[model samples]
Target: MNVHLGKTPVGLDGIAAAETVLSHVDGQQGELIIAGARVADLAAASGFEGVTARLWSAATTRSISEAEVRASLGLARQRAFARLPELLAATSGLTIVDGFRAGIAALRPEAGLDDEAAIVGACPVIAGALVQRARGSEPVAPDPDTSHAADTLRMVRGDTPDRGEVAALDTYLVTVSDHGMNASTFAARVVASTQADLFAAITAGYCALTGPLHGGAPEPVLEMLNAIGTRDNIRPWVDAALARGERLMGFGHRIYRVRDPRADVLKSAIERLAGGGADLPFASEVEAYIRTALRQKNPDRVLDTNVEFFTAILLDALRIPRQAFTPIFAVARAAGWTAHAREQQRTGRLIRPSSAYIGPRP
Candidate 1:
């Protein structure tokens, strides 16, 4: 086969590999849209189920009601719960996120199963099971009557979540549900383009999100905050880190030259959840100091606070363990992954890209 030699940008930067209506990320404007709805608006007006239904509708090119989506996801959760014993047995001794990946792998997609619902529904259960097992406690089963965000908290804590907690979790889930063709979403589409099952494609997405450069920043953001300890240490620690040419966690983004839009939405969510708590005020102070220090250090570069900064605060306030941060991200992002996978499968063309050879000629 003759390979086409075309000019290719490094990392496929500024490349439009596939056209998608599921989500759009305008880095220049620092905006994100999911299926014609702005992220901020969607996060404010809808829950995870609503946003997920919209994404699914876009991917399948069919209209689906929120009630229908809720029912399907509830059923998926029950199906996944039925396999808990097998999942736990197979994922023994693995880390939380790895356990999630393992559980997904164990679930072979079948013709009768709603692949999208099954993958999205199973992630939270897997994440909750991993958290519980780590605490030497048995996993809690899903409550079909409860909402996804509410049930997730219930499963992990083995108790009912308050209304505020459920709202915060729902906002976080909706905000991070989709963001264009990001690294993990792209990986998912690649797998799906090959006519692979939704489980396989979503597992590929999880593999990509597990990398430190992607969904792994929120935990380290908490670590950085903990190391700072107090407001007085914020400037000194940030200045010292900048002097050493070290990148600050949660301060910068790859695409957004301006502030990340998702950051503001999550910041508001945290503010609502914290509601006069010392942690939120302190986090805000530290964020201000960090922003000032970064601007002073690199006057040209806009190193504003990204989504991970507030994510750390919000998840911490929710009492989610640091180790499970990335897993939670996967739980939220699974909706996007499955939607992109279905869209790619609809295209019916394999995602084949050419590589630029710079080595010795054969």
Candidate 2:
């Protein structure tokens, strides 16, 4: 079947590859809607479990209550924890996120295992374990009674997190739970279109996320902030980077022509984090400087703040290390990945696109 290819958009930009009921990204307006709810409304009203339930219900045509979702995910965490020895062995000598990918890949592909719950549940456990292992501590088991965000914090940090900390993390998770057909989500859907199982689909999502063009920007955003070190250094640092033709890590996004709504949501969460600390104020100042400088420099380009800017701030404030940012993103985004996988599976069509043969004719 030789499908005629028109002028292919670079990087599949402005291309509608597949239909999704999961989420919508309106780039021109900088809006993100998940299921039937706006991102800001959903992030404010729900935690990771509620959002996950909503997404799952939308994807699978199953009506799952938030309570049921939370309970299932809690049990799933325990189930995932049972495979710790194998997970650790598989992840040996890899970077933290790579460890997470390896650990996820190691999950037993059993028909009886609830794939959605297992993938979502296993991600946090693997992520927390990697953090604990890096800190020279044994991995903590998930407390099945705790919320997913709270348990993740408790497991990773080895202590009870206060209400504010949990709330902040919950907001971060909900905010990033899903965005439109992003690179990783698209990758997951592509794999799913092949009738792959949930685990394999999400594993592909993690692989796509490891690429710097996708979910890998948060750590570099942190590095940029650290290099600047103070609000005063923002202009010179950004000028030097722009002058060298280097992309500003968090100031732009391919989908968001305006300020990313997720950025605004996370920034608000940072504000609500009891006692807006020195870091919040410093970040605000740096953000202001960068926005002003970038507009002046480009004048015609819409290089506004994206999610990574405040993601770095919020995660750093939560005391999550820079290296763990992408993994943590995967932890939240796994819900979306699996939901999209299920959606694509329902379509029962392989997403096989034809590439225009621009090379010499054979």
Candidate 3:
């Protein structure tokens, strides 16, 4: 049996090709390219709306305006809500992944047809369901006039978010839009390769993210913060965590050799909403202490702060309920899932990986 699958001949890693347009992840150097540009360079030049538009345009021939994205997502939110009661009943007592899978099955599009509008649109719908579930409330209707970010905030909070909160949510979505071939995106591509429809593929991706290793970090990230109780307790908390063998929730990544760029990007957004002065300073102190202690204890696995660290921070700042963090991740990630699904379909090959089959040869 081969220990690792040989590098895929057709799939390009670390290098950019023309099929999909969005950020490219240079895992080795920890760099991201958005629409034929680096994230840092793009950061100084563009806002969330521009990057999202550029990514969507690159994949689809249709020209979908931001207004259209808003309208479609708004519609999807209502549609998803209408289905929620049944979904909630069906998914009772199940794990979130199982429940989400139930929701996906319940919400799967009729017929064999694929609709980009529906696929791009289902993001906030799924997000709304997960958010409402977390809050112990029934799903709410989506507002058509609002932007995707703003409407999501409204749906979750039952009121429109202030400008700062909306801006922060926009930045969060943009920051998480794509991250090379992280676990969930990889799961999405694998399912898409089998020619699964967009919803199925995205459902598979959501399952991957529901695991603790990926999208689950954000919930614990905030818990860690709350456990510290006060600013002064942060260092001791870090020390105690180090003394035990617990890995810090949000402080590392597989691809990023340096810092995760998404962390800094979302941190900027959090600063805007959370008044990034004293709290941010406290966060910085906690991060620094964790880094030093981890390095001292285990030099090889450095475990620097990753995206989840500040993801929790920004979401908390936006007054988003803690339980909904992973669901929000799924919503933002749906865009990339849809885009990738379309890309896989264009390639038109079924994804089939062969196993070694070492058990008792026939």
lDDT measured at residue 174 in model 2 versus the true structure, 0 to 100: 92
Give the deviation of candidate 1 from the true structure as CA RMSD.
2.5
Name the runs in model 3 displaced over 4 angstroms.
1-21, 40-50, 61-64, 82-89, 92-98, 110-114, 133-138, 274-278, 357-362
lDDT of 2 by residue, 159-225 (tens): 8888988999999999999998999999999999999788889999999999998988888877877
* Per-model RMSD to reference: 2.5, 2.4, 4.1
Tens digit of per-residue lDDT, candidate 3, span 9-72: 4334453323455457765677787667776555455544455565666566556565555555
Per-residue error for 88 in candidate 3, Å, reads: 4.6
Looking at candidate 2, what is the lDDT of residue 1? 39
Cα lDDT of model 1 by residue, 240-318, tens digit: 8889998889988888888999999999998788552328888888888889988888899899989999998898888
By descending TM-score, how would the candidates be arranged?
1, 2, 3
Give per-residue lDDT, candidate 2, residue 69: 85
Task: Assess each prediction's global lDDT (C-alpha) against the native.
Answer: 0.88, 0.87, 0.69
Better of 2 and 3 by lDDT: 2
Off by over 4 Å in 2: 1-6, 109-113, 275-278
